[model samples]
Target: MLIVTPVTPVTPTKTNFEFEIMNQNIVKALAGIMEKPGTTKRDTLAISRRVTRYICQQRRHLLTERHALRRKARKLRQYLPFTALAVADLEQQASDHNAELLEAYRRVLAAYGRSIIHDEEGIAAALGFDQLAALLNINPVHHEQAKREGGETLQGLVFVARMEDSASGFADEWGAGGPLFEACMAGLADFIRTCPDHLLPDPFAPGEVFGPKLPPQLRMV
Candidate 1:
């Protein structure tokens, strides 16, 4: 009779570490979802939600910065007349910088809006509008009309008049009408979060506490 010795099972420490690494990479990718589009098969609704939330956050941040600059200028205005000239120059510079940042943000939104059109079916499924209509007892004809009206596809049926409009007129609107646009985006994001049958997890969920840092370009400067 031969005695057989039992071997100990391998520890799960390495497996756990690998899982952590994978999670980190996913968080990082989601954070910069707009950086390289068409490279991944991301869910349209998920991307839309994330982008909307990001736009809201960035708009608020930029507004706060602008307010702070204005406050500084106002404070300086109380001093000498020479300081008034300097304050005017400072305000002009701040306005120019804000314009540049707004332009960059508009480009991001335009790209996102086009992507939404590119994946309309995916977005429709993610939004579960059909289910919503059934729950609300809405007419099918009205629902279809709401989504597309007069040869134009509405941005998520309410945000913008048309998908293509996002790149041109919508972009201009966002820059000029920042608060209203931010509110629309916020509402859309909220709808995405509460939409039924949504499979994508929230990018800002608490489980992402140890997520990788955002790239410098993605940061609100």
Candidate 2:
């Protein structure tokens, strides 16, 4: 007679790593639930909460990175207006300044990378969907035209969705109400926690809002 030993699974130490795997699991579970809608609210919420916690952890990681990138992107945005103005007011040196501005824009894109694969709006643009990008209010055709014309009229150059959108997106999904909503909303709250005081939007004056309204929370920046 022979005996067999069970293998022990290894768990990731870093929360991000754990969440990354958990995200896949949650997506699969959601798909399974979609196939058979008889899942109890308690079970659904339990799964949603787990997914939400994972999302919160991922958002925290992005938030930390966002602080640095936001400043860099903002600076790029500021330069675009200035460069455009220089082109308009001081035509001769416009070519040189435009080159510099283009370089700065490249840097911002390189820094942002394709990490936002989960977000459809971002992924589409990141994958070079110029028309879709225009529709998404990210790198709109008018902005491109303005860039080509060297004009400073386009005010909303830098677009980043507010933290609230991410949670709301998941909550707003059909057949994902109740506990799922609470879970997603909770995830957004966690994202807010990672934000610095400066990043936090003021109640009196909100930040730039772009992307799908129906999805609720799905930002592309």
Candidate 3:
């Protein structure tokens, strides 16, 4: 259906505010999936839908948190040394800010408590990520939770949806990935390889080849 890269957790842009919040909301809701105790499912679509629906308010939350975080981080800088400092002072402020940040995200995460996994197996088959049914571990998931913790929400939703859709279509086209997949892969490779590394603009204009249709400055014998 589509191909795209996932957006970051936090974005520094004006237009993508809502999407940022939705992504944060996702991290909040599927935190369990990221936490030690994780989700149990074989279907990617169901999982994605479940995660997506919970953050109806993601857009708002992202901006609010972003502004709040920037303000707090600024405050932390005043307390920084970029040099050695007393153990107690460093420990106190670091611990304090970390807790504040953690609690803030946790509140948002809790917002997505039961919204994951709606249609179950249907979505998994759709995305073709159904085979990745097992949770390899929690830390990595939590790390993913952290990575997308502050990205543009709308972008992420769009991104994942596109990948699933693209993969699904490709699967159908090549019958679960074959010549069609290779063709697409080859196209991308060619694009990367043949694309000009850099092209400097010409300094001089070309001699006038023609005024409109006839050649310019031509002399008949």
For model 1, the superposed segments whose C-alpha errors exceed 4 Å read 1-28, 31-42, 78-80, 96-101, 117-122, 125-156, 160-221
List candidate 2 segments past 4 Å from native: 1-22, 71-221
Ranking by lDDT: 1, 2, 3
Q: Per-residue lDDT of 91-172 in model 2, one digit per residue for the tens?
A: 3333233345344333322222221212323323333334323322333424454233321211111112211123234223
Candidate 3 minimal-lDDT segment of 10 residues? 150-159
**Could you tell me every candidate's TM-score relative to the true structure?**
0.40, 0.25, 0.20
Clashing pairs in 1: none
lDDT, each prediction: 0.47, 0.37, 0.35
TM-score of candidate 1 on Cα atoms, chains taken together: 0.40
Better of 1 and 2 by lDDT: 1
lDDT of 3 at 62: 48
Quick one: best TM-score, which candidate? 1
Off by over 4 Å in 3: 1-85, 110-221
lDDT of residue 216 for candidate 1:
45
Candidate 3 lDDT by residue in tens digits, 101-165 = 44543434332221221222332333332232222111323334322321212112222211223
